[model samples]
Target: MTGRAATRRPGLARVGATLARAWRAVSWYVKEVVGENDYEHYVAHLRRHHPEARPVSRREFERAKLDRMASDPGARCC
Candidate 1:
């Protein structure tokens, strides 16, 4: 290949890698901000630390979390 073509390939590869890393970071940030990944982490934790315990479904977990937050006055701001 020519010099220009070879340089373009490396530049393209670097751009692709940078985009992939940025996408992953943004994806993770969105999930955490929206609490979407909480259950996934909870399930993983249960599997690793409490093999005999059953994991809560996402709906139930969300419901319980809401109830707990509501009951705890300290969890909210006036």
Candidate 2:
């Protein structure tokens, strides 16, 4: 490879390592907060905290969630 290409190798390696660390942190947080159960309890928790979370069909919830995700980059779908 050329000199420039060789120079970029370490930068790419550092970026890859940073991304791996971030992914691991997120994975650990999810496991600790939500455990391995389905999302029903979390939904219920939300309803308890904010009584406005009335019952809605699963299909509608999923559709709205997907739409929000498509429009908002900051939204987390999981």
lDDT of 2 by residue, 1-78 (tens): 599999999999999999999999998789767643234655787788978867666666667766876888774554
lDDT of each: 0.91, 0.74
Best by lDDT: 1
Candidate 2: C-alpha lDDT: 0.74
lDDT of 1 by residue, 13-73 (tens): 9999999999999999999997889889999999999999999889999999888878887
For every candidate in turn, the CA RMSD to the true structure comes to 2.3, 12.3
Q: Clashing residue pairs, candidate 1?
A: none
- In order of appearance, the predictions have TM-scores of 0.75, 0.44
Error of 1 at 39 (Å): 0.5
Backbone clashes, each candidate: 0, 0
